[model samples]
Each structure stands twice: as C-alpha cells, then as structure tokens.
Target: MFAAWWKLGFDTTLLAFEAQSVIALRMAKLAAGGTAAQAEAQRMVSEKVLAAGEAAMQLATGASHGAVVAGYRRKVRANHRRLSRGAKAI
Candidate 1:
C-alpha cells in the first residue's frame, strides 16, 4: 500500500511540474506579444498627435495673417478718408 501511494504521488508531481512549465511558456509568449502591440499603439498615437499639432499651428498662422491683412486695409482706408477731407478744405 505504501509503495502504491509513493508511485501515485510521484506521478502526480511530475504531471504538475509539466503543466506549470507549459503555463509559464504560454504566459511568456502572451506577455511578449502584448508588449509589442502596446509599443505599436503608442507610436501610432504619438504620430497622430504630432500631425494634429502641426495642422493647428498652420491654421493659427493663417488666421493671424488674415487678421493683420484686414487691419492694414482698414488703416489704409482711414488714411485715404483723412487725406480726402484735407484736400477738400484746402
């Protein structure tokens, strides 16, 4: 009876060890794949953010230029009006 118990115990231990090894290998594979995917996702997001920032900067620059042009045009019109009134008085 004792011998049978020992044999059974040994077999169970061996099977358990094999199962643990397989589980560890699978976990390693999953972790590696997850890490690679995470890196790729981060890189893509960063690229998208960079692109958005560049577009926003371009839009802001265009708006500022337009505002300056409009202001300059208003100033020129005012100057012309003043000169015309002065000429009429003279």
Candidate 2:
C-alpha cells in the first residue's frame, strides 16, 4: 500500500513535467501554421476528449488512485517518447 502511494506520487511528478513538454511541443506545432498544424490541433482535442472519457470510466469503475496515476503516467511517457522522436512520429 505504501509502495503504491509512493509510486503514484513519483509517477505524477514525472508526468507533470512530461505533460508540460508535450504541451510545449504541441504549441510549437500549432504555431507553425499548415495542414499538419491543423491535424495537430485536431489530434490534441481528440486526445483530451478521449482522456476525459477514460477518466469517467475509471471513476465509474472505482479505480484506485494508483491505477489512475499509473494510467496517465504511461500515456505521458508514450507522448514524450513520440514527440521527442520527431514532429511526424506522433
């Protein structure tokens, strides 16, 4: 139980930083102004909506705090990897 809580806290902190970087990269993509920028904006909105749906499902299912944090941590890690690779990878 203690380990779960600790891992949740650590993952949350790392996600926070990675989330910021993802947003920064997304912002830069949007600012570039092109068809790809339009796609990027749409993708961002779609992802947010999907995340909200997942959160709703988690709430309804009574998922643990650790589970919720871990889910988001995984997502942010994937996003960090994708965005870090290149603008076209994601």
Could you say which candidate leads in lDDT? 2
Clashing pairs in 2: none
Cα-based TM-score, every candidate:
0.34, 0.80
> C-alpha displacement of 66 in model 1, angstroms?
86
Highest TM-score, which number?
2
* lDDT, each prediction: 0.50, 0.80
RMSD (Cα, Å) for all candidates, in order, is: 37.1, 2.5
lDDT of 2 by residue, 1-90 (tens): 888778878978887888898988878778888997898789878988888789779978999766777777787778767766767664
Model 2 local distance difference test score? 0.80
| Pairs with steric clashes in candidate 1 | none
